[model samples]
Target: MMKAADLAAIRAIITRAKRWDLFFSLLGILSLMVGVLTFTVLFVDMAIQGVPRLSVDFFTSFPSRRAEHAGILSAWVGTVLVMLLTALAAVPLGVAAGVYLEEYAPKNWITDIIEINISNLAGIPSIVYGLLALGLFVYYFGFGQSILSAGLTLALLILPVIIVATRESIRAIPQSIHEGSYACGATTWQTVSDHILPYSSAGILTGVIIGMARAIGETAPIITIGALTFIAFLPTAPFAGDPPAGLFDWIFAPFTVMPIQMFNWTSRPEAAFTVNAAAAGFVLVFMTLAMNGLAIYVRYRLRKNIKW
Candidate 1:
């Protein structure tokens, strides 16, 4: 039989472990609290200073000057155009490539080379993409610094991210789902489209949304690709003008987007421009927040609708 003293010692050892676990838990909680508090303070400060300057004119009219500067309308429109066209250029192709690689591609040296290149492309700095666009669109192909040029650059810049995201989303579907479909004599395409795609749709959308948020904040690549700080006209259909020249008109034609405009406003010598910058910053923050909120909503719905 064990002695009472021995029993007491074992209990003491277990008690000591419990204390250490509680201490670490307390430490983790404190760290989280500090992070939350810091974020709150910074966001509150920005909002306090920024809310007053955010007016309808700030949204509707073109930037005029100091107190009287009218709006961010043109910049907002350009940013939308850039993002939309970029999405058109990147999404379907990226998703299709991801689907093919994740689903159908044989693992071979050629495929391995492509995979390696895709991963490297993801890590390449955005400015490098700008240079690629500059060389291809401006100097070599001569697309000019137009909206299409910026869109094409951003499309390339975001492709790896979207492809990686799409692959992950597809991979998350259960293999059993595919096997079951196959047992039912469903073709591979039908099984993938009907069963796998819907289940992973939310995750894929989330990844795209997150990627777009990052793209919206980009400046260096767009600048390098010859996105101008100011443009008199809104971007319409790309390649509508007389072409076949250097196509410099294609890629190098001057364009502007919100982030570029904000950077320009902030760098000006005038205080009014600085104010416009802050206001623009606030708008950017809002847009980013909305995108995140959408991702969260989509994720929630996905979880809710999915059955065991």
Candidate 2:
């Protein structure tokens, strides 16, 4: 129905549109390259300055008043302990809430309200979470300035992310899978546990790892919870000694994490401490990268194994 001139005009328009799309795509790739390059340069610089300082002693000894003798033993140990607590607190609750919302909750105004609140919570500033922890956990609940307080604060911060990730993963499972399970005389719990959870594990794990990576690097919330910045001693052992400090003693102990330790070192006037900060930064970056890599590997393996 179109004449030759109109056909040519349409072709020209499409050509221009494709040209613009290609131009924008190239621009976006360039931007990504720039970011990667910048991070590479910074990482290289830090490695040069800090790698020489790293030794077995750096991991074995505790923080010292003298920069030459300072180490991150307490800092790293507290970091691990806090992260363990965060995982224990956040994962089960987040997963359960997500499962309930996606599978059991009725489609109603209450569900909509809950969903909206979660979406808003995800966008809230980390510092605000810190303040809330300070008020509720530290003061109101009598958690004190302890690892438990810090861990719980981070748990709350990452809960929304985990819930959303879980819900999305569950949603991705084909409805036919559910129907087939029901057709086989499977209960709702059995259907979810057998079909939905196995298929969604990869996505959920990826989200959890990402959330934890973010939590490890967080300084504001822990600081607000009154985490000590100059700890030189590890928390009381959970299960060692003639009479153990009790399994929960460490939770109530004062602690310092790698991020806060790095921050404290960076704030000092000495060049040596600055170098220490760089080394700690390198460790933290390495940890975060390892977590992300694990998440990627898990997703790849799961996707590969399950064709659907």
Candidate 3:
């Protein structure tokens, strides 16, 4: 029923659109490569500068006045302990808050206010969180300048991220899944436990890992809360103190993390310390990459297991 002229005009329009699409496709690839190549080049440069410094002695020794003798044992141990405490505090609370808001909280003005505040909080600068922690955790609660304070500060910093990720992940599941579960006479808790949580685990885990990656690299808040820049001794191992350490004793111990250690080295006047900084930076980047890789692996395994 179409005239030849009309067919030709329609074909021309599609051809023009296809050309534009191809242009954009190439543009997108170029943009992505620019970022990837930039990061790869920098990472390679850092490795070149730092790889030689990675040795058994570097990992085993503690900080020293001599740059050549300096190591990151104390720093890495503190980072791990702080991160463990942060995860322990943040995961359950963030997940619970997200689950409640998305599944159970009534849609009211108060809920809207809370949601808005949480979103705003996520965008606030890290330094603001540091100030808040200094006041609330350090002064009010008397947590003091210790691992407990740093862990709590970073936990608060990442809580909103996890909560947002959780809600979004839960929202993504098909409505029919919920309906089907209820149709089977499952209780609310049963449906959520048996279906919702399992289905969204990949997304939740991804968010958690991302939050932790950010937390691990945080320096401003830790410094603001009085983390020592040159701590040499490790926190007391659980149950290994002179008086037989209490279970939570280390939480109250002073600590230093990788970022602070790197900062300390980079600030030194000596060239040798600069090499140490580069090495520490390399290790930190590798840790971040490892966490991201774990996230990808988890997401893959979880999605592969999912029937839908």
- Candidates' TM-scores? 0.83, 0.91, 0.89
Q: Is candidate 1 or candidate 3 better by TM-score?
A: 3
Give residue 149's error in model 2 in angstroms: 0.5
Worst 10 residues of 2 by lDDT: 299-308
lDDT of 3 by residue, 87-159 (tens): 9999999998888898778999989998999999999999888999999998899998899999999999999
Candidate lDDT scores, in order, read: 0.81, 0.91, 0.92
Clashing residue pairs in candidate 3 are none
What lDDT is obtained when candidate 1 is compared to the true structure?
0.81
Q: How would the candidate models be sorted by TM-score, starting from the highest?
A: 2, 3, 1
List candidate 2 stretches off by more than 4 Å. Answer: 1-26, 239-243
Q: Write the per-residue lDDT of candidate 1 for residues 173-251, one digit (tens) a residue.
A: 8788889999999997888788877877788898889878888889999899777776556544454655534523433
Residue lDDT tens for model 2, 1-308: 88999999999999999999999999999999999999999899889988988999988788888987999999999999999999999999999889999888999999999999999999999999999999999999999999999999999999998999899889888899999999999998999899888888888998899889989999998888788899978888878767867988889999999999999999999999999998998988999989988988987886788766
21 in model 3: Cα distance from truth in Å?
A: 7.5
For model 3, the superposed segments whose C-alpha errors exceed 4 Å read 1-30
